[model samples]
Target chain A: MTTLTHPKYGAIWFTLVVLLGISLLGPLTGSTAFVLLLAFGIAVVKAGMVAAWFMHLAVERRLIWFLMITALALMAVLFFGVAPDVMRDQGQNWGALAAGKN
Target chain B: MIDLLLKNASRSGVEIDKLFDLITFLVGFWFLLAEAVLFGLVFRFHRSRSPRALYVSGEEKHQKRWIAVPHVLVLLCDVVIIAGTMLVWSHVKQQLPPADAVVRIGSQQWAWVFTLPGPDGVFDTPDDIARVNELHVRSGAVYHFELTAQDVIHCFSVPAFRLKQDAVPGRLIKGWFAALEPGRYDIQCAEMCGIGHGLMAASLYVEEKEQHARWLQENAAPPRELVAFRFPNP
Candidate 1:
């Protein structure tokens, strides 16, 4: 019955807390893109930590590994499916507005 | 039955109504079948003498209902529903409006500013009136609003018009709506701003093209003269 009280996990959680605090304050009056990218990167790191420790995938059975891999593949497919939407303009040309030249 | 089902199935918003109906149907169908089996087992396998409960580990090929047929059917139905939703979403997103007019919408502190290109294809002009909490548009016309916020991030939403757009500081997002009928719509702030978020509301008036123009002209005051007249050094 091992609990989630490990020092390494504590460090990771602390880092996540700090990152979240910074994210809350950064986007308010400072750079928005920096805050967004940092927040997203922190999320990726946190997800990795959760998968490695909380789920205990490192010592799990082979079938569980197969299921995790399949899920990841499906997620990848979904990501690619919606990639065009986030990347594509889809609307009017907002380049001039973005460039502060409008 | 067909008429009733058709009437029940015809509601807007997302496709939640039909999905709920389908889910209810599937769950009810399964519950009835399971209940019948459970009742039959209770009646047939009644204990007349000292009888023990059978312990059956369903691991073998014959014992295990591998790839449960009903579960597979449910998964297939979910996939079909998701695919159908995706198809509808794609169609709605790709359909470009024929007469879409771009309008600039700005949110600053507790006020809303709507800028319209005053027949000259230019936004900043004397004719442009900065209204605090009102937006006027013509009915049956696709109006695209470019949303931008000054202080904090705010969301411009009108539920009746099915419109929602985020106004981020230093960035311009967009939202569009086409009113089928002429009426007054409530424009509410969907995002949590500062203390005045609850009070952040505006009015959207959808009228005929001619009526909209006439209303703008009547409500807006004439622009002041640039040169100031003064009597100095007398």
Candidate 2:
């Protein structure tokens, strides 16, 4: 965390509250896609705001960014690598997932 | 196997128990060995015996051998486990034999409603017998159950049969079991569905062919206006 600018916590909190309201009300549109998009898209923006301003990662060194990205990449690799075994409903030693054909 | 103590009750329960035994043995062996090695090392290199700090980085080839040997051995054990899992999955989940009797089971928030093919040996007619929290099946007969959730996700679990299947909302999951003995068993909702999930229990009756027929005859409804069974909100 090495941000040079001082953050206005009040404004940030106000923005987060507004985003939370929109996410909560997104389902009222009756579109699953819209609800999901608004919920997650706002979540991403909120997270970035917290990390960049509150956590003060905006002015961090390039090396810190690289390290963080590398950690995220490793997590992705671990998740995706095990996804096939986790998701598939095919047979293995004793049994497979209880995934039935519709 | 745990089934040795529980008395394996269904066709698939035997194989499932064997798999469970293999896993238990392997994991038990490894667990004991690891604990022994750790204790042995700790006792040998105690502070009272050796006052000087002896730091081992585990960078040397010989040091790495301890990790390597167990790594290979554990991998082999993993292979055995995966192989066993695949075989059972094929038999239980992947394959569904032709059913001697078909039952429709609907899971609601707090109860199970079983629709048995009535005396005419058919479903959805005026004679379909819908009972709450009770499932009756003939022993020695293969049964296919179409499981569905009325409102929320639930699990159809019979521990005696070693059967567990998720009853997801908007899905008809078909699973089968061949009854072995004529007895009564407990059916439990394995998944958390609502405030009353812990109370969502049922009874499974495995009756002889003749007994089941008698039950069907005794409970058979006369031809009348068809009415679907629905649970009032819990």
Q: What TM-score does the predicted chain A of each candidate obtain versus native chain A?
A: 0.53, 0.77
Best-fitting candidate, scored by DockQ? 1
For model 1, residues B15-85, the per-residue Cα lDDT tens digits are: 43444455567666768978998888887777854277777677776666643766787688777667766
Candidate 2: fraction of native contacts reproduced: 0.00
lDDT of each: 0.64, 0.83
Q: After superposing candidate 2, which stretches have Cα over 4 Å from the reference?
A: A1-102, B222-234
Residue B62 of candidate 2: its Cα lDDT? 97
| Tens digit of per-residue lDDT, candidate 2, span A1-102 | 333778788999899999999999999999999999999999989988888778667767778778878998999999999876555543222223233385
lDDT of model number 2: 0.83
lDDT by residue (B38-107, candidate 2, tens digit) is 9998998799877898788999999999899999999999999999999998889878878898888888
Name the lDDT of candidate 1. 0.64
TM-score of every prediction relative to native: 0.53, 0.69
By summed lDDT, which 10 consecutive residues of candidate 1 chain A come out lowest?
A: A91-100
